[model samples]
Target: MSVKETAQEVLKKIGGSKNVESVTHCVTRLRFVLRDFSLPNKEEVASIDGVISVIEQGGQYQVVIGNKVSEVYDEVLKELDGSDPTDKIESKAHHKSLFDKFTAMISGIFMPVMGAMAGSGMIKGVLAILTITNLLSEESGTYIILYGLSNAFFYFMPVILGASAAKYFKMDIFVGAVLGAALIYPTFIPFASEGELSFLGISVNMMDYTSTVFPVIVAVWFASKVNMIAEKFMPKDLKFLLVPAIVLLISVPVTLIVIGPIITLLSNVLADAVNAIYNFSPALAGAVIGGPWILMVMFGLHWAFIPIFIANMASQGYDPMMGLLLANQFAMAGATIAVGIKTKNDKLKALSLSTGVTTLFGISEPALYGVLLPNKKPLIAAIIGGSFGGVIAGIANTVQYSFGGSGLLGIPLIINTSGIDNGFYGGIASQIVGFIVGFALTYTWGFKEKSTVDSDDYSGNNTLLNTKINVNDILSGEVVALSEVPDKVFSEGLMGQGLAVIPNDGKVYAPFDGVVTMIFPTKHAIGLTSSDGIELLIHVGVDTVELNGVGFKSFVASDQKISKGDLLLEIDLAVLKQSNFQIITPILITNPDKFSKVSHENNNLILAN
Candidate 1:
């Protein structure tokens, strides 16, 4: 489907444009705040044409639409009359639980900057590897370039954090960014590095503010609020220019003179606390670090952890948290690949395979949205696997001497040849064992049967028959038996054999006990997997995936077992037909190649057993 149409369909399914309280997009999903979570036709909404999945987490209703989420979000905004998606009524201050609020706040601040953060993090990892291998020197020009590339983000993090914080605060982001940039101005760095002194007799402390965190974020957040207030007083024509000027004039000096030092001190305290805890109990530390890794990934909050990882590496010449995080990512990727291979549905298989590939390359949104979240089992399995691996790494005192990539391929970075006594092999062994165990556990226990049906009956001969009928009868618009459709694959077929009567009503019924495999969010197509291992794809109309699987309801689930003729799915085919959807229902064997001589008769009247 066209991207525009896809966006429109999603908007309609989620209770139309009016139901959306607010909308925003990060790297991979359209994050929506709705007036109510209980929207009409939620099942149907989920079946919408372009949606990957619907998730309710962090007090927001999220639609997973792959990497083009921002483009789709922009299109959605344009359709909403240039409305800013982030402008919503303030949620109750205390409505969310403490933990939820914390996660939400962290996620909102970091999500927007995640893409750049990951790029820089990966560069640093690569540079570390290069330096450790002696492929590059600390004094080399090449090393300088790579180091600069990695360091640039940290050195100017306030700018990025400011923009993100402004979004979170619902204020002028550009203004906030300018305020942040002022905090890191080169002229101030010299004074910041010096001892405490009086700035015009007010007494200011010169501290090393480079690569600092929290202070700039807090400053920008306050600046954004200040900008918002200034914007209200300024004329609309001058608001944009005046608001920033006013906010910066007031905010920058306050941040430099007051807020920066306070926040920097707080950051140090927090860092010290975390370090103390890690020093006291490294295994507990690993669990603490690894446990929330997936949760961090879910909301894109992991970016907040990057600065700490880098800080640890720089100061200690090693960081254990990153090694554990690497194992966690690899475990998830491995589990996803396993599930992709185990799934039977063609569409699901394709999604899983594609997601798996992307995950291996450090892009895990596809896997997270397409497979892990929906299946539940795989997600849990991955978490368990990650925890196990993390604990092992932690117990082994595994540390990455160099910042290496966070995945299976980056294992060599953990080897501390010059510093640690064990030659880094212990960390390597810990990661390998953790990954293997995690994969094995996931492969064995991660895939719960999404369908509750006998696999054999769906694939075996049934108590049905095609007596006799003419293909001309069907062509002549007669209510001929489905067996007369003239396709041997459907007429006398074993895999997807089902009666296809030109029903007087636009209703659909389950052919046997099965779970609804897929009801296209557009409601254009439906797939079912019978308990007897038969996978069925029934396209109600031509180009129905274009419909976004709207107006369809699945009483069953992906791996649910059912009895023969169970009520698996309900669809308003009449609505579909009226809405420009084709009704050429095709019930084909998704796994036809698995069996031999799968036959059907095009000119026969078939009777259900």
Candidate 2:
């Protein structure tokens, strides 16, 4: 499906735009805050074509969309243009714990800026490479310009974060930016270093706000609350002018006097605590963090660490946490490759190999969800491998000088500002240990290929049926070839073959006398196993699962015995058609391998008999 289609499908399944309280995208996922959390079906969202997985954690509904998340995010934004107005309903977030709300706010503010941050970090990494090689002197004009390019984002972080945080807090974006600018206004910067200062006869706590995280976010939040009060009291005619004026007037001074110093201190404490843990025992810290890194990513808990990472970079100019994460990526890749090599299923082999390569490039969601996690053992092996890599990196005191790099490509990020050192070598060694150990362990005993017979390879099943199973049409409709069905799973015969029908009526009769094996909660599909052992699937419409059972009606319960002509389901054909869902129903022989001569006869005319 096209990215736009994926976005639309996702939007529909998540209760359309009305249910979304807010939405944002991080590196590889679309995070949503919803008004009604129960509206979305996790299974349906995950099954969307471009979606990798669905996670509900930290009070956010996250749909993993791999690397193209930004594109999908843009499309989602376009579709959400008419989203329900704020104040119309209370967000589900209000009931979440303080920590959940805080994480959501952090992710909302930081996610938009991460790309630029990563890009700037990469520029710094590249500059390091050039300077170390002696190809570019630090004193050169070119170096000066490149250095500025690398430093601009971090140096002016407050302004960028102000704009993003404004969106989250529902304040004027430029006003939020101006509030940030007030902290580092060029004329006011000198007083911070000069020590004692007073504003409006109140002693102002002077602190440099450059490259900071928490202060600006807190400031914007404060401004949003103040703006809300100003709106309520200020006269409508003068509200626009005075509200912002009053907001900036009150917010700027309050932040300089109160929020800035407090948050900065807390941020430092957090960063220091992290460093202390690593310092106490690098190997143990590495093992502890590395062991569950993939699981953290899966649950969307990793976003909580972004602030600490930025704080480390701001205070120490280097961060060790990223190295542990990179190790996990290599471990995931290694385990995935092993699965590819060991899996006997051709489809699984292709998926494993492709997702393995993606993991090597720093996108591990596909590998973790599609391959390793499903197999269980490979996931354990990957975690074990990552722990070892983390230990090695910890012992070497490896740190990332900048961000943006992951997997093997991120090796340059470990180069210390002084020059190439033991840390860089440690990073390389860690990845090697991670990949090799993950591969070796998984290859040795982590995986066992499950045997299955491919339909194309069937030899002994040619004449196995002792009696002919005559199938009848379950619905009155125009017969359509299964190969022409819109869904690939049916069109390609991947789910076995039968035929499709464009229904002119709603009722579905049993195709053969058998027990109903399954009935999807959405009621868009049903499964049956014939008395003679023929398994059949009757799916009402292509992509109709997104309808959430709105127009589908089940007439028979699962495990119920039925005759060939018994009523089974009732689809509201007009309702489905009105909603733009294709009403072409597919009747499939799910176990076509058991038949030798599966053919449609009598001009493909199927009738209940």
Candidate 3:
């Protein structure tokens, strides 16, 4: 089906475009704020073509469509006559819970700038390595410049955060930037001294805002509120002139006098809490912290520790909590590598290997999402491995001297400048233990191989060998780009690129002589390998995996020979449409690289050629 047709159907199933207050999309879901939740039929919406699932969370009805959500959202906007919810209406109408609102706001504000922050941190890590090795002089101009480059992002964090927060808060970007700038202004910071500072007889408290998180965020939220009020009351002609002026005038002083001091006190309270936990029992604290680092990081709950971590670093020149996280990332890397080595599936192996390398460097999301989470046992093994490593770290009382993002580089970062120490050497030993324990445990007991032959194996991608091979048209129907497939695994060409078809006939014909190596229980997906070793995976309908065997009838079974034009499967199109399932079947050349070049005829064929 055409994208337009699919979009129209989706809109209709969700109570039409008129019922939608606004629509947005993330990586894999279409988020909708409806005028009335009672108006839309959720089960029917979930059954819609191209939809993976339906979720109602955080005051939004979400339609999961995998990687192609952006495309569908664009189509949705067009169908809605380009009407979108205004900023004020969106902020007011979402009705999200406090926790949800706070997390969403923080994630939205930090996501864009986080890449540069992490990258620059890695650069600093490398410089630390060079200096430690005596390969680069710490006093060199090159070192100074590169170090400055690394520090600049964090030093002016408020500016970057303000711009992003302003967009989320529906305030002027320039005003937000100015708000960030005023916090870090050199002259104003010195005047923060108690009894030494006054602004027109109002006492000013000495509060440091540099490299802080809550103050600027709270200030921006206040500024947004002030801006909205200013807009409502100010003259229309003077809105542009007076709105920002009024907002800044109210927000800055309020932040300085009230918000900043309160947040600083809160930061101290949070720090004291963490310190108390560590002092209770470092080993138990380390184990508890290390086991769930990934979960904390995923939900952004780890931000709560930022003030503590930064404060510890400033006061004592190191943070012990940093010691706990290093083990966790390395353990994740180890688990992923074990999966890569133990699995027979090629795609999973490749994914695990790549993600494992990043995990080793303290970038664990790839490993977390791609390998560990999907495979339950590996997650358990990695966490246990991390706990062991954390216990080792706690016993040694490990501390990191420098803050750099890489877990692999943490070894060097922890090294004391004057000389070597037990903490640095013990951290290395702990990471090694983490890697070994994670890999060994997962490889031994965690991974479960799929019980299937060539066709159903989830791992392999390319199976081409050295020789000339026959290339024949796979399916005879209306051809569509593989990228048009709503599922990211196929649409991104990650599963091997091939066109799809809207079957002209209800029956699926075999494209080449092959053995039906695998036939799924649902009969929605079939896998075959030709005598020449060309694997083909024919999946009928978008997200039909959810439908089980309904409306699908298989004529062939596993280990059966399939000749060209032989009837393989039959589908009841009428039943499919009534069930709200798509009829766009993807005929993928699962191992396209096996042939020098592969192309489909995409021709109208009454019978197989």
Q: How far is candidate 2 from the true structure (C-alpha RMSD, Å)?
A: 8.5
Q: Estimate, for each residue in 46-104, the C-alpha lDDT of model 2 and write its tens digit.
A: 77899977877788898989878989999999998866565365445336787777777
**TM-scores for every predicted model:** 0.65, 0.74, 0.62
Q: How close is candidate 2 to the true structure, as a TM-score?
A: 0.74
Best by TM-score: 2
Question: Each candidate's root-mean-square deviation in Å?
Answer: 9.9, 8.5, 12.0
Number of the top candidate by lDDT?
Answer: 2
Alpha-carbon lDDT, every model: 0.62, 0.81, 0.71
Q: Write the per-residue lDDT of candidate 3 for residues 1-609, one digit (tens) a residue.
A: 566777788889877766776566655567776766655655567556667566665556777665456688889889988544342222224456786666555555655566676666667667766787888897999999998997777677777777767876878988998998888888877776534556667876857677667778888988999999999999999999889888889888888788878887887787778888887887787788876776676555765565477667655666788877668878889999999998877888987998799777665665775678767789888888888888788777777765656567667667665556777777887788788889999999878554221212222223432322222244446777665665544554445545667766678777777899999999988998877786778888876765788888999999999897788888877877776666777666665544444443333111111
Q: Rank the candidates by lDDT, best first.
A: 2, 3, 1
**For each candidate, how many residue pairs have backbone atoms clashing (under 3 Å)?**
39, 0, 6
Which sections of candidate 3 miss by over 4 Å? 1-96, 193-195, 314-317, 401-404, 409-420, 453-609
Off by over 4 Å in 2: 82-94, 453-609
